[model samples]
Target: MAGSIATAGVVCAVGIAAAALVGIGAAAAESQRAAGIADAAALAAADTLAGFAAGDPCSRAGEIAAAQAGSVTACDIDGLIATVTIETRFGAIPVTAIARAGPPL
Candidate 1:
Protein backbone atom coordinates (compact mmCIF):
# COMPACT_ATOMS: atom_id res chain seq x y z
CA MET A 1 0.00 0.00 0.00
CA ALA A 2 2.83 2.42 0.75
CA GLY A 3 4.45 1.70 -2.62
CA SER A 4 1.12 2.31 -4.35
CA ILE A 5 0.77 5.66 -2.63
CA ALA A 6 4.25 6.67 -3.70
CA THR A 7 3.49 5.78 -7.31
CA ALA A 8 0.27 7.83 -7.21
CA GLY A 9 2.17 10.84 -5.86
CA VAL A 10 4.69 10.62 -8.65
CA VAL A 11 1.91 10.50 -11.24
CA CYS A 12 0.25 13.51 -9.73
CA ALA A 13 3.47 15.47 -9.80
CA VAL A 14 4.03 14.58 -13.43
CA GLY A 15 0.52 15.64 -14.31
CA ILE A 16 0.99 18.97 -12.60
CA ALA A 17 4.23 19.54 -14.43
CA ALA A 18 2.60 18.78 -17.76
CA ALA A 19 -0.15 21.27 -17.07
CA ALA A 20 2.36 23.94 -16.16
CA LEU A 21 4.29 23.32 -19.35
CA VAL A 22 1.15 23.71 -21.42
CA GLY A 23 0.32 26.97 -19.70
CA ILE A 24 3.79 28.31 -20.34
CA GLY A 25 3.58 27.39 -23.99
CA ALA A 26 0.29 29.21 -24.35
CA ALA A 27 1.71 32.33 -22.73
CA ALA A 28 4.69 32.26 -25.04
CA ALA A 29 2.43 32.01 -28.09
CA GLU A 30 0.39 34.97 -26.90
CA SER A 31 3.54 37.02 -26.38
CA GLN A 32 4.75 36.24 -29.87
CA ARG A 33 1.42 37.24 -31.36
CA ALA A 34 1.49 40.52 -29.47
CA ALA A 35 5.00 41.25 -30.66
CA GLY A 36 4.06 40.59 -34.25
CA ILE A 37 1.11 42.95 -33.98
CA ALA A 38 3.27 45.71 -32.53
CA ASP A 39 5.84 45.36 -35.28
CA ALA A 40 3.30 45.45 -38.06
CA ALA A 41 1.46 48.39 -36.55
CA ALA A 42 4.64 50.40 -36.16
CA LEU A 43 5.74 49.73 -39.70
CA ALA A 44 2.34 50.60 -41.13
CA ALA A 45 2.21 53.84 -39.17
CA ALA A 46 5.66 54.79 -40.37
CA ASP A 47 4.70 54.19 -43.96
CA THR A 48 1.61 56.37 -43.58
CA LEU A 49 3.61 59.15 -41.99
CA ALA A 50 6.11 59.11 -44.83
CA GLY A 51 3.46 60.30 -47.25
CA PHE A 52 1.99 63.00 -45.01
CA ALA A 53 3.36 66.54 -44.67
CA ALA A 54 4.63 67.33 -41.12
CA GLY A 55 1.38 68.14 -39.38
CA ASP A 56 -0.10 65.79 -36.79
CA PRO A 57 2.01 62.99 -38.13
CA CYS A 58 1.61 61.07 -34.92
CA SER A 59 -2.19 61.06 -35.02
CA ARG A 60 -2.12 60.01 -38.62
CA ALA A 61 0.33 57.26 -37.79
CA GLY A 62 -1.85 56.15 -34.90
CA GLU A 63 -4.82 55.77 -37.19
CA ILE A 64 -2.87 53.55 -39.53
CA ALA A 65 -1.46 51.58 -36.64
CA ALA A 66 -4.94 50.95 -35.22
CA ALA A 67 -6.17 49.64 -38.51
CA GLN A 68 -3.31 47.19 -38.83
CA ALA A 69 -3.33 46.05 -35.19
CA GLY A 70 -6.91 44.74 -35.46
CA SER A 71 -8.21 43.64 -32.01
CA VAL A 72 -5.13 44.86 -30.17
CA THR A 73 -5.09 48.13 -28.27
CA ALA A 74 -4.90 51.38 -30.14
CA CYS A 75 -1.46 52.60 -31.16
CA ASP A 76 0.03 55.70 -29.59
CA ILE A 77 2.05 58.03 -31.81
CA ASP A 78 3.86 61.21 -31.02
CA GLY A 79 5.45 62.99 -33.97
CA LEU A 80 7.79 60.39 -35.44
CA ILE A 81 7.34 58.12 -32.45
CA ALA A 82 4.90 55.20 -32.26
CA THR A 83 3.93 52.93 -29.36
CA VAL A 84 1.48 50.08 -28.81
CA THR A 85 0.12 48.37 -25.69
CA ILE A 86 -1.20 44.78 -25.68
CA GLU A 87 -2.75 42.59 -22.97
CA THR A 88 -2.94 38.83 -22.84
CA ARG A 89 -5.42 36.50 -21.13
CA PHE A 90 -3.27 35.99 -18.04
CA GLY A 91 -2.83 39.69 -17.34
CA ALA A 92 -2.03 43.03 -18.86
CA ILE A 93 1.19 42.81 -20.86
CA PRO A 94 2.22 45.93 -22.68
CA VAL A 95 4.14 45.64 -25.95
CA THR A 96 5.83 48.68 -27.38
CA ALA A 97 7.37 49.51 -30.79
CA ILE A 98 8.77 52.67 -32.23
CA ALA A 99 9.35 53.92 -35.81
CA ARG A 100 11.40 56.87 -36.93
CA ALA A 101 12.57 58.28 -40.26
CA GLY A 102 15.43 60.70 -40.44
CA PRO A 103 16.60 62.89 -43.25
CA PRO A 104 18.94 61.33 -45.81
CA LEU A 105 22.49 62.27 -44.95
Candidate 2:
Protein backbone atom coordinates (compact mmCIF):
# COMPACT_ATOMS: atom_id res chain seq x y z
CA MET A 1 0.00 0.00 0.00
CA ALA A 2 2.85 2.41 0.87
CA GLY A 3 4.60 1.74 -2.45
CA SER A 4 1.36 2.41 -4.31
CA ILE A 5 0.92 5.77 -2.53
CA ALA A 6 4.51 6.75 -3.41
CA THR A 7 3.90 5.92 -7.05
CA ALA A 8 0.76 8.05 -7.11
CA GLY A 9 2.66 10.97 -5.55
CA VAL A 10 5.35 10.68 -8.18
CA VAL A 11 2.77 10.72 -10.91
CA CYS A 12 1.13 13.81 -9.48
CA ALA A 13 4.46 15.62 -9.30
CA VAL A 14 5.28 14.74 -12.86
CA GLY A 15 1.92 16.00 -14.04
CA ILE A 16 2.41 19.30 -12.25
CA ALA A 17 5.87 19.69 -13.75
CA ALA A 18 4.52 19.06 -17.22
CA ALA A 19 1.82 21.66 -16.76
CA ALA A 20 4.35 24.24 -15.60
CA LEU A 21 6.52 23.61 -18.62
CA VAL A 22 3.58 24.03 -20.97
CA GLY A 23 2.66 27.32 -19.37
CA ILE A 24 6.24 28.53 -19.75
CA GLY A 25 6.29 27.56 -23.39
CA ALA A 26 3.04 29.38 -23.99
CA ALA A 27 4.41 32.54 -22.40
CA ALA A 28 7.55 32.35 -24.52
CA ALA A 29 5.50 32.06 -27.68
CA GLU A 30 3.40 35.03 -26.69
CA SER A 31 6.55 37.05 -26.10
CA GLN A 32 7.88 36.15 -29.52
CA ARG A 33 4.58 37.04 -31.13
CA ALA A 34 4.64 40.44 -29.48
CA ALA A 35 8.17 41.03 -30.72
CA GLY A 36 7.21 40.19 -34.28
CA ILE A 37 4.28 42.56 -34.15
CA ALA A 38 6.49 45.30 -32.83
CA ASP A 39 8.99 44.76 -35.61
CA ALA A 40 6.37 44.88 -38.32
CA ALA A 41 4.79 47.99 -36.86
CA ALA A 42 8.10 49.77 -36.60
CA LEU A 43 8.99 48.93 -40.16
CA ALA A 44 5.65 50.06 -41.44
CA ALA A 45 5.99 53.32 -39.58
CA ALA A 46 9.50 53.80 -40.88
CA ASP A 47 8.27 53.31 -44.39
CA THR A 48 5.75 56.05 -43.81
CA LEU A 49 8.43 58.35 -42.39
CA ALA A 50 10.63 57.73 -45.40
CA GLY A 51 7.85 58.95 -47.73
CA PHE A 52 7.34 55.49 -49.14
CA ALA A 53 3.89 55.40 -47.53
CA ALA A 54 1.21 57.88 -46.55
CA GLY A 55 -0.53 58.47 -43.23
CA ASP A 56 0.44 59.34 -39.68
CA PRO A 57 3.44 57.22 -38.70
CA CYS A 58 2.36 56.23 -35.22
CA SER A 59 -1.21 55.73 -36.33
CA ARG A 60 -0.01 53.43 -39.08
CA ALA A 61 1.97 51.44 -36.53
CA GLY A 62 -1.01 51.07 -34.21
CA GLU A 63 -3.16 49.85 -37.04
CA ILE A 64 -0.61 47.28 -38.11
CA ALA A 65 -0.21 46.02 -34.55
CA ALA A 66 -3.98 45.72 -34.09
CA ALA A 67 -4.26 43.67 -37.25
CA GLN A 68 -1.67 41.27 -35.87
CA ALA A 69 -3.59 40.65 -32.60
CA GLY A 70 -1.51 43.13 -30.64
CA SER A 71 -1.87 46.68 -29.36
CA VAL A 72 0.71 49.42 -29.70
CA THR A 73 1.74 50.54 -26.23
CA ALA A 74 4.03 53.25 -27.53
CA CYS A 75 5.53 54.62 -30.72
CA ASP A 76 8.28 57.14 -31.26
CA ILE A 77 9.77 58.52 -34.41
CA ASP A 78 13.16 60.20 -34.55
CA GLY A 79 14.11 61.46 -37.97
CA LEU A 80 13.90 58.37 -40.20
CA ILE A 81 13.85 55.92 -37.31
CA ALA A 82 10.70 54.39 -35.90
CA THR A 83 10.50 52.67 -32.54
CA VAL A 84 7.47 50.76 -31.37
CA THR A 85 6.40 48.92 -28.27
CA ILE A 86 3.60 46.39 -28.54
CA GLU A 87 1.69 44.12 -26.20
CA THR A 88 -0.13 40.84 -26.69
CA ARG A 89 -2.08 39.11 -23.97
CA PHE A 90 -2.20 35.44 -23.14
CA GLY A 91 -5.04 34.85 -20.70
CA ALA A 92 -4.70 37.58 -18.07
CA ILE A 93 -0.96 38.02 -18.59
CA PRO A 94 0.42 40.72 -20.87
CA VAL A 95 3.48 40.07 -23.02
CA THR A 96 5.25 43.07 -24.52
CA ALA A 97 8.20 43.77 -26.82
CA ILE A 98 9.92 46.74 -28.43
CA ALA A 99 11.50 47.09 -31.85
CA ARG A 100 13.12 49.78 -33.96
CA ALA A 101 13.58 50.14 -37.72
CA GLY A 102 15.48 52.66 -39.83
CA PRO A 103 18.58 53.19 -41.90
CA PRO A 104 21.89 52.03 -40.46
CA LEU A 105 23.33 54.90 -38.43
Candidate 3:
Protein backbone atom coordinates (compact mmCIF):
# COMPACT_ATOMS: atom_id res chain seq x y z
CA MET A 1 0.00 0.00 0.00
CA ALA A 2 2.82 2.41 0.89
CA GLY A 3 4.54 1.72 -2.41
CA SER A 4 1.34 2.40 -4.34
CA ILE A 5 0.89 5.73 -2.55
CA ALA A 6 4.42 6.80 -3.36
CA THR A 7 3.96 5.99 -7.01
CA ALA A 8 0.73 7.97 -7.13
CA GLY A 9 2.39 10.94 -5.50
CA VAL A 10 5.21 10.89 -8.03
CA VAL A 11 2.75 10.75 -10.90
CA CYS A 12 0.85 13.73 -9.55
CA ALA A 13 4.04 15.71 -9.17
CA VAL A 14 5.06 14.98 -12.72
CA GLY A 15 1.68 16.05 -14.01
CA ILE A 16 1.91 19.33 -12.16
CA ALA A 17 5.35 20.01 -13.55
CA ALA A 18 4.19 19.32 -17.06
CA ALA A 19 1.30 21.74 -16.67
CA ALA A 20 3.59 24.48 -15.41
CA LEU A 21 5.91 24.02 -18.35
CA VAL A 22 3.04 24.28 -20.81
CA GLY A 23 1.87 27.48 -19.20
CA ILE A 24 5.31 28.99 -19.42
CA GLY A 25 5.62 28.08 -23.08
CA ALA A 26 2.30 29.73 -23.84
CA ALA A 27 3.30 32.91 -22.04
CA ALA A 28 6.57 33.09 -23.98
CA ALA A 29 4.74 32.74 -27.27
CA GLU A 30 2.33 35.50 -26.38
CA SER A 31 5.17 37.80 -25.40
CA GLN A 32 6.89 37.20 -28.71
CA ARG A 33 3.75 37.97 -30.69
CA ALA A 34 3.13 41.15 -28.74
CA ALA A 35 6.69 42.30 -29.33
CA GLY A 36 6.41 41.73 -33.05
CA ILE A 37 3.19 43.70 -33.26
CA ALA A 38 4.70 46.64 -31.39
CA ASP A 39 7.79 46.65 -33.59
CA ALA A 40 5.74 46.80 -36.77
CA ALA A 41 3.57 49.57 -35.43
CA ALA A 42 6.53 51.70 -34.44
CA LEU A 43 8.14 51.26 -37.81
CA ALA A 44 5.00 52.24 -39.69
CA ALA A 45 4.48 55.29 -37.53
CA ALA A 46 8.07 56.44 -37.97
CA ASP A 47 7.85 56.06 -41.72
CA THR A 48 4.71 58.09 -41.83
CA LEU A 49 6.09 60.79 -39.58
CA ALA A 50 9.21 61.09 -41.70
CA GLY A 51 7.09 62.26 -44.67
CA PHE A 52 5.39 64.98 -42.68
CA ALA A 53 7.01 68.41 -42.43
CA ALA A 54 5.30 69.47 -39.23
CA GLY A 55 2.04 69.66 -37.26
CA ASP A 56 0.78 66.95 -34.89
CA PRO A 57 3.15 64.30 -36.11
CA CYS A 58 2.84 62.57 -32.77
CA SER A 59 -0.90 62.25 -33.02
CA ARG A 60 -0.67 60.92 -36.54
CA ALA A 61 1.98 58.43 -35.60
CA GLY A 62 -0.12 57.21 -32.71
CA GLU A 63 -3.03 56.60 -35.00
CA ILE A 64 -0.90 54.64 -37.44
CA ALA A 65 0.62 52.63 -34.62
CA ALA A 66 -2.72 51.72 -33.13
CA ALA A 67 -4.04 50.71 -36.52
CA GLN A 68 -1.17 48.34 -37.07
CA ALA A 69 -1.20 46.86 -33.60
CA GLY A 70 -4.98 46.40 -33.58
CA SER A 71 -4.88 47.67 -30.02
CA VAL A 72 -2.39 49.98 -28.33
CA THR A 73 -2.23 51.57 -24.91
CA ALA A 74 0.18 54.37 -25.85
CA CYS A 75 1.47 55.62 -29.18
CA ASP A 76 3.43 58.73 -29.92
CA ILE A 77 5.82 60.43 -32.27
CA ASP A 78 8.41 63.00 -31.25
CA GLY A 79 10.39 64.81 -33.91
CA LEU A 80 11.70 61.99 -36.08
CA ILE A 81 10.96 59.31 -33.54
CA ALA A 82 8.02 56.97 -33.22
CA THR A 83 7.06 54.86 -30.22
CA VAL A 84 4.33 52.31 -29.55
CA THR A 85 3.23 50.26 -26.56
CA ILE A 86 0.72 47.45 -26.39
CA GLU A 87 -0.63 45.22 -23.66
CA THR A 88 -2.85 42.18 -24.06
CA ARG A 89 -4.22 39.23 -22.17
CA PHE A 90 -3.88 35.86 -23.73
CA GLY A 91 -5.62 32.92 -22.01
CA ALA A 92 -5.61 34.52 -18.60
CA ILE A 93 -2.00 35.64 -18.97
CA PRO A 94 -1.01 39.28 -19.45
CA VAL A 95 1.66 40.31 -21.90
CA THR A 96 3.16 43.72 -22.65
CA ALA A 97 5.73 45.06 -25.08
CA ILE A 98 7.08 48.38 -26.34
CA ALA A 99 8.78 49.33 -29.59
CA ARG A 100 10.46 52.48 -30.80
CA ALA A 101 12.03 53.71 -34.01
CA GLY A 102 13.51 57.00 -35.07
CA PRO A 103 15.44 58.65 -37.82
CA PRO A 104 19.05 59.75 -37.34
CA LEU A 105 19.22 62.75 -35.05
Measured against the true structure, the TM-scores of the candidates, in listed sequence, are 0.61, 0.95, 0.76
Per-residue lDDT over 1-105 for candidate 1, one digit per residue giving the tens place of the 0 to 100 score: 999999999999999999999988977876676566556656555555565444454455455545645343555656645555433343555444333442233
In model 3, the runs with Cα more than 4 Å from the true position are 52-70
State the displacement of the C-alpha of residue 94, model 3, in Å, after optimal TM-score superposition: 3.5
- Model 2 C-alpha lDDT per residue in residues 13-81, reported as the tens digit of each score: 999999999999988888888889999999999999999999999999999999999999999989999
Residue 13 local lDDT, model 1:
100
Candidate 2 lDDT trough over 10 residues, lowest sum:
26-35
Model 2 clashing residue pairs (backbone): none
The residue-level lDDT of candidate 1 at 31 comes to 65
Q: Backbone clashes in each candidate structure, one number apiece?
A: 0, 0, 0
lDDT score, candidate 1, position 66? 57
Q: Give me the candidate number with maximum lDDT.
A: 2
**lDDT per residue (tens digit) for residues 1-105 in model 3:** 999999999999999999999988988888888888778767767776777444454455455545644467787767778788877678766677899988876
